[model samples]
Target: MSQRVPNILLEQLSDFINKEMGLFFSKERKLDLLRGVSLAAEEFGFSDTEMCINWLLSSPLKKRQIEVLARYLTIGETYFFREARIIQALEREILPAIVEKRRNTSRMIRIWSAGCCSGEEPYSIAILLSRIIPDIESWKIVVLGTDINVDFLDKAQRGIYREWSFRNTPFWLREKYFIKTDDGAYEILPQIKRLVSFSYLNLVQQESPEYLNLQGFDIILCRNVLMYFSQPQVLSVINRFYQSLNDKGWLIVGSSEASHVLFPQFRTVNFPGAIVFQKDLSMEVSRAENVLFDMEIDDLIPATTTNYDFSALLNADNSIEEEAEDEDEFTKAVNFYEQGKYKLAAELFKTLLNDPVFADNPQVYILLAKSYANTGDLKHALHWCNKGVKKYRLEFQLYQLQAEIYQEMGKLDKALDALKNVIYLEPDSFAAYFIMGNLSKQLGKTKEAKKCFENAEKLLRLKERDDVLKEFDGITAGRMIHVIESMKSMESPG
Candidate 1:
């Protein structure tokens, strides 16, 4: 019989996996870690799980070995139109904005699906564009799908899928865009298949990402993938993504994974049931050309001022100008926020709110709230968020931010109400339903909690079985259902 993997061995493997693969396996997940390692052991030419564990611990794993391990550690199950609301937002709001903006100019659109598995996502993007763009033939469209798993990439390249892969897809999608093969698998039509290019990418291990021309993308989708990574690795990957996108480009993550705290560099754009990160290259450019603000100040200062000592007066004016230029409040607050100086950021952002130039800007309100929240000042965070909501009643992100603050404060009822407003504004939001379910359970509202969980399950049923729910940190829909069932069973009396 194959020996059972020991606890000590499992602990060592967990650390090694986190260090080498940037995938974390906490003590609670050691069994999962052990199981994955055991599966990888067979591929590594070892039958005994304990022996494979020791071997993996003793030496640095090769690229191929890590790739094999990744196949087991990461969930690859995905289907067309997996996150229906997110896809709808892209098709209705985002793509139209990009197309109209570029129609008169470059007529080019580039989308990257980072961690794309089995080609479903990028292919869906291509298909969506094909449906929307009237002159798609004239536009230079690049939809790139990249994954670390070679097997996944090979399957993606083949463009064939069984009925299982069509779960939650529209009835007409397959008939309209695919051809039935003799082997009984549906193959993506040539036109759609040719629109997407599949490539191998190890996001964690890539020393240089430029080889893939990983820049100037109009949209990057890295959904449900970062939850597996260590916190530092997540931050590193997110920052790299920030650099890769074009000005005003969008980053669509799993709704549950969306957080202003995590993506402070990007501006939040909320669509119905979705929150996407946008690269504001204009802000970076403004910071870069802050010297231009100096020219404005120079022009404002009188060329000749009435004074007894003209040269001395000019020197004093020069000192004053230098001070004003150095103290650009908005730019300094953004820099402080980026540097993680929440107190200083809050102070600076507060200063901007009083200025006529920034008083009405919703971004200022959001940033101020985030700065306060980061510093553990929930009261101030909620206050600013409420102020933002009052000013921009239609802005759903403000309500979302308010809900987070209430949850952090352990005010479950308030949090539930805040999330209700979020749902009212964005009825199809999976995150709202999932989070509200947890909050309802915490408040001992068993029936309400069940209703919420059932609502969430209905949304999950529309996804592939193995597809991870982003907000729950790598928990698959099937696993989450099991959790809900277990909770119910435990709560039931004999």
Candidate 2:
């Protein structure tokens, strides 16, 4: 007979798990946690669930014990080609461009599948890569699959799967990449098997030195994982992901997890069938191509022009071409900003400000301010932001940018004023309220902070769960609500 866990003990265990592993269990999830704890007690040979919870709380858990707990608590609910559009985008668009770019270089491509369960996602990538690249033997390809669950990693290492894993996978893929086993399981072919490697990685616990030592990956897929983590943990992992990617590398999260708040640094690239974030390296080149393609030559020369000066026409064309080049330079500056080459970006942005065409562009001023701010030139950043506000008085983003600079400079009052301006301009601005909450908290005004957080949460709840919370850095609204609730809990008295 199994011993029952009390509600108090269950809450303690839930809190323990959340703090240690960064996995939150809501009121509804507490039952699931209790069930997992019961299973863990049985596995660890505890007499009762209370005894198991006491043991976990009293001392540091062993590696094996942690693995046993993970097996019970974490769900391994995934399939090969789970989101087919992402895979299709990789196959038809992303991989080909990467292949062509790296053809003359080292011809090396590295991909990471974070939280890979049962080895399906990474193997699918390997199989896809194999199909895309001709003369595959010449190129060095690496697909690393990592998960906290040792059981999942072990299964992934075996590279064998049942029919359920291929529920959404195309039929032709199985024929090409897998062999049927006598036990009715399918084993991945050696070709696909050799391309992938699996390892145990706790996303929350992994240090920068250990995980980011071998940076400059071509692509990273961390889908459906951040949804399980706390805001701070998710932010930490996303920052690491940003550092891990090479210039122009891609990061693909689950569709629901995409957020402007969480991924403010990444440039969102919308493909025909999918959207992926990129650490943009060649922004200028892409911008220039788009500009050229978009310009209508017929529009430039009026259809009624009977005796248009050929030299004037040529000069007009030359001006349009120069404008495109100037736009390209602006994009290059923005790219520099994204890459943390802020000093270089600031210089370029300043030079562009001298151009009459760009002088009045609010975006140019905003970028200049951001670049200065990033490089620790708060004085100049404030100056540019002020100038932007004077020129575009109603621009809410300018005020928001000013608030950020003020906050960075320790001008709390000024930051609050700027945030107020942002809120006044855009009443539904979740970011402004969130910032106000942080500012209030810093000043020890717990009540004000709590109210601000509540306001932000209410506004966020009104939006789609999957919509990137631009105010929170690209984290989803669902995740921000968790963050707010956590903050509210801390603010509450014992």
Candidate 3:
């Protein structure tokens, strides 16, 4: 007979799982959480569900306990070419561009499947690359499949799959790439398996030193993984993804996770029934080309014969071109900022201020200040932030940026005041409330922090479950609510 877990205990387990594994379970999914825990209890040597729950909540979890729990809790439900649209996009558009770019130069390609479950997705990628690239033996290819679950990695390393894993795919793929074992399970061909390597990685622990080698990727497929993370964690992971890619590299996220708000810095490329983000190259070269063409056309005209002041006309044309050039420079500066070249980014952002056209732009102020803040030039960062706030008083983002600079300077009171100004501008901003909550907690204002957290939760509840809160860095409303609940539970006295 199965023993049921108590509601209160289930809530605590939900919080624990979310914090430890970056997986979320809302109130509606408590029964699912209970069932997973119930099944994992036997493996953990617990006789009953209640005892297992108590053991988990009793003390800090050991790594062995976490591994056992991960085996049961995480879902490994994926098939070869699971999302056909993404595969098609890769085959037709994305990969061809990459191959064309590297065909004559590096002859190297790297791809990472961040949440690869049971080895299917990365193998599918290898198979696709083999079909697309000629003389494949000459190319240096690496397709990395990483997951938090060791069991999944072990299964992936074996390169075996059942018929269920081949659902919706053509029979020829099996015949071409897989061999039938004695037990009737399909084993991937040794050649296809050779192209891929499996490893254990927890996305939440990306900041740890072990993951330092996770850079210089050509394409990263993190489909359906970010949905499980809390909003702030999702933002952090996305920012890291931006850093992971080579210049002009691609990022393919799940359809549900596709939001311009989440990936604002990346260029959104729309294909047939699919959308992917790319780290675009700077537009400076193209603008300079345009400038050269304009000058060439001016050179063709007779300079002395024309009654018109062609010089002034050229200056007018140059003025328009200069604005476009500044915008391109801004884009390049943002790329530098994302790449952590903070000093270079700061220098470029300062030049944008010489032109009032770009200076009046509010984002210039925000990024400029952030560039300085990132470089540890807090004084200059605060100065720009305060100037931005003065010029764009109604812009809540400036005040928010100012608050961050103040917080970095350890001026907690001023930071709180800036946040208050943000609330005044946008009364229903849940993110503001959330940030204020953390800031309050930092100041040791426990009661005020609780009130702020509650307010943030209230605002989140009014949004649709799947609506990505852009202010919260693309976390869905439901996940934020769960995150708040988890924080409250941890703060509560037992």
Assess every candidate by TM-score: 0.62, 0.58, 0.56
Whole-model alpha-carbon lDDT for candidate 1: 0.72
Q: What is the C-alpha RMSD of each candidate to the true structure, in Å?
A: 18.7, 15.5, 17.5
Displacement of residue 489 (Cα, Å) in model 3 is 15
Q: Sorted by TM-score, highest first, which candidate order results? A: 1, 2, 3
Model 1 stretches with alpha carbons more than 4 Å out: 208-212, 284-413, 416-475, 478-494
lDDT of 1 at 92: 70
Deviation (Å) of 267 in candidate 1 = 0.3
- Counting clashing residue pairs in each candidate, in order, gives 0, 9, 0
Better of 1 and 3 by TM-score: 1
Residues 1-494, candidate 1: write the lDDT tens digits: 27586778787887788778776666656767777877888988997988887887788877778889988886576788766657757877799899999999999999999889898889889988988887788999999998877789899999999997777566778888899999999999998887899887778765735235888899999986765565556667887888889988999886445754566678877553356889996654333223322221111111111001111111221112222457678877766664446798899899898899989888888888988876678799889999999999887778878887787677778888888998899877666776787677666787887787678667777788677665553447765554444334334433
Q: Residue 65 in candidate 2 has what lDDT?
A: 69
lDDT of the candidates, in the order given: 0.72, 0.73, 0.74
Sort the predicted structures by lDDT, highest score first. 3, 2, 1
Name the best candidate (by lDDT): 3
